[model samples]
Target: MSFPDFAKVIAALPSDDAEWGPRNTAPEGVPAILNNAPYAPYSKGDKLGRMADWTTDSSKDGRDGQRGGRQAYNRNFRDQQVYGAGASSLFSLQHAEDEATFSVVDNQRTSTKTRGGFGRGGGTVFRGGRGGRGGQVTARGGRGGAQGGRGGRGGRDDRYGGGRGGRGGRRFGWRDFDKPQRLRDASVNIKPDWKLLEEIDFSRLSKLNLETDEGEDVESYGSLYYYDKQYDKITPKGPEKRLQISERAYYNPTTSEDPVIQQLAERDEATIFATDQILSMLMCAPRSVNPWDILILRQGNKVFLDKREGAGFEFVSVNENAIDPPMDPTDGNKESINAPQALSLEATFINLNFAHQVVSESEERKFSFENENPFYNPSEETEPLASKGYKYRRFDLSVSEEEPVHIIVRTEVDAVIKSPVGKGDQFMTIKALNEFDDKAQGAGGAPNWRDKLVSQKGAVIATEMKNNSCKLARWATQAILAKADLMKIGFVSRANPKDAGKHVILGVSGYKPREFANQMNLNLANGWGIVRTIVDMCRNMSDGKYVLVKDPNKTVLRLYEVPFNTFDEDLEAREPVAEEDEE
Candidate 1:
């Protein structure tokens, strides 16, 4: 209990030599089982720490401090020796395989380096051979150090040590060179039995030009109604003015199906016959992105241009040349109802309804052509006929008077407006551009029509010219063929941004056909030249059916001689089924 008792207790304890005596020695009566294994001793200098110290790594040492790499050692106990440091090698496993060959993937990018002035001290060397130490630099260039080479006073060296102002051995614009090319599918399948006749690219077709005079009218059919000026007075903002759904009878018979074209072919009137739609596509082939095909049927000597039932050419493509065009349902994109295919069908539907709804479809105000509607039958058809006028025009494609080569085309006019002189009417062609979703991908940077149509109609039309270049070009070409005085473009958008079922008209803009052609850089002579070239190719062939298809992947057109029954199955499938009258 006192100091004297504590001193006696400490003096009675064992000395240091005895406490540090052989640990391999067995206790008083126990057998020495571990005597041959040798004692693994610890140092007295080692400090007592936690049972399991996890914060131990070479990189954690103060001198080797590296962030985010390893656990840091405690500075207080850093100098103390570890208890098992000497015996660690005895417990470690040694295998014959080398572990250094293993690879590890790291995604961290290096920090950007600051640009330094030339002839100054070189930057830090991270990886590479070192340059000549304190030697005069050669005129060619100085060799790069570990990180990359440095520019000298004599010449500018590249990062890869390229000679004198050279781009390091690295390639420039590699992104474009390495980008994958898109492979698109053809609009029509080429059967194995088909024969290849020729392949014509846009580059070669654009070089050919032929100046031809304005075509002369052969005959006219169908009737057109006066345009109702009240429709143009609608406000070009908001959903207050919505498009009306007007059901009317409209016909789209192919060139061969036209009774007049067949009669002309029988009479040997000309060497070639085509519709305005087909002719315009051929003429403006160089500007097209979507693929199309025209069926060429050559009988004895005359050639007829026709299209398959439900062909892609029936609909106009929106933003066909956009950097990121609309994707199809199968392309893995969220297939909104407003996909390219759907938008095209919607555009076609809009044009048909817009033309019919804007016209005063009255029996008394209608103007009849030279002949009655060729495809319309009042007795069989129930719906009122739409306002459309068909004019058959003949163009001379002869190089000389001795060899006269003529082609006839069927063009259509949508509506008629009173002339400025108040004597006659001025024919017009009506077309519409529909917007699905401006915020959606592949919109081609189109502005909201409802917001900009009233204030900036010219800007809106210019955007359409850029995104729908091929479609607008075809429309202009058709108007030119019909010799129309004005071309009208209607801006239409969805009534609801997310809904594709309903749409409303935003505004209407009109331009003279010739002036619009000039603004769009549409060359009629170039188009005629393309038509003549194709006609010449088919003129010498034997009597059969030929298909001229635009290559989907490249800017080229290929002519193939297909069997006469190539598209017969589709036609048979499309036959209308009679419906029972509802109560």
Candidate 2:
């Protein structure tokens, strides 16, 4: 609480106005609430999970009996003492002094009874606490775990219900915090009973699986699963892998949200995360170019990122600015603090050496999940919003090729960095190549092209090229080669053609190819096509700083501004989104 809040609290007390909402309305600012609190022992009933949210003065009972009595929030320094069913209040007008000890009287029934469990079928085992309506009410967190136990004398045959008249707690609206329901797909409560799932034989579900089994008699296990789909009896190999990661994914560089550049305008923290919301960056430290060397490499006009292979990239925590390598000579160990001038690992190339999600002869993705493939177009002019990726990662791999996915790029798991020279570049760390070295016998054309006598070590480049079949990877690779054609990538903010503005992006992700291409007279497709050209240009620009701006005139997200970084003004590229047609 600040000084201003304290002053406000003082001024809003009783002296403020004698009659305000029957002297019980909560103070205007914040409320003091007590949630999930146990009721007084042997009280009328057990009520928890929201204590002191209400206060009653035995006040007037309005229409509908107002639950019978007028209940008000007692924020004006008032306290009430409640006793069990057998005990009386004994009555007192003065407020209690002990702030540590606070209690409330509940009108709910605080009793317990036995119950029986049911089998898989609809038939019931027995009735009581665990059975039907008269069954036991499950108790949870509270004094002595308030789910069971008895009240009053000698355990009577009584069934308690949820709160009702005289069943609520005393004094409310005071809480350390409130537990709001989460909006994500997973439940905060209710773990999926996989064990029970295993016990059930999918083959035995023939009757249930039969198409004719539709009707009221059909077996339905509430939240056990979703709409009728062939269950994968084999069980998912890695169900946990699909669990949603809370961190934000990298955004296309054309968007301003990439954590790497967003903060460029504000803080100077060298080891900053590309995600503004996350404090930690997945560190691939120790002489990996600058702090963020993970490039979104491209060749020609193609991108070369293999999601599965990217997983091989290491993710650690390190200070980008404080890297210090060992000064000792003849240190053969390469994983040093500061990489040797010759030792380098670039994110410029794509890695693709990971196991793919295996599919059975019949198993395959079939759902038309939204833009799951950025390239696949809609069947009709419009598409169903059902499986769209815009929502969450719920793509049914069986029904759609899209799986709940996240890529972790590890040098071992993904692709490796390609040095200036194709194959011999790996050995170039110790020696530089001369301009005219025709006599020098190097990686002889083929990558790692070794004479088979050396155990075919030369197959590394061939193997990489073989596995690098993804079109995006190819495009990115091409884009890397096309660097000389571009002076700088012009992130088009507006496309009026008259005063179109663009954020000139300096190089990122290690793409230092030839000169920049001028867009002045180069006519392109749509404004978005222009942006797409640039998004692929910047490697890992992952932050949702820019969103598709709907023109309202059309459904296309084609109008968005390139956010400016005043501090990085000097880093702007020399080229602009030129109005000239392709010369």
Best by lDDT: 1
lDDT per residue (tens digit) for residues 282-325 in model 1: 88899988888999998888999998765568887888976556
Best by TM-score: 1
Judge candidate 1 against the unseen true structure and give its global Cα lDDT, from 0 to 1.
0.74
**All candidates' lDDT scores?**
0.74, 0.21
Count backbone overlaps in model 1. Answer: 2
Q: Against the true structure, what is every candidate's RMSD?
A: 20.5, 29.7
Model 1 TM-score on a 0 to 1 scale:
0.69
Question: 431-458, model 2: which lDDT tens digit per residue?
Answer: 0010111111111112211122124422
Displacement of residue 530 (Cα, Å) in model 1 is: 0.1
Residue 370: error of model 1 in Å?
2.0
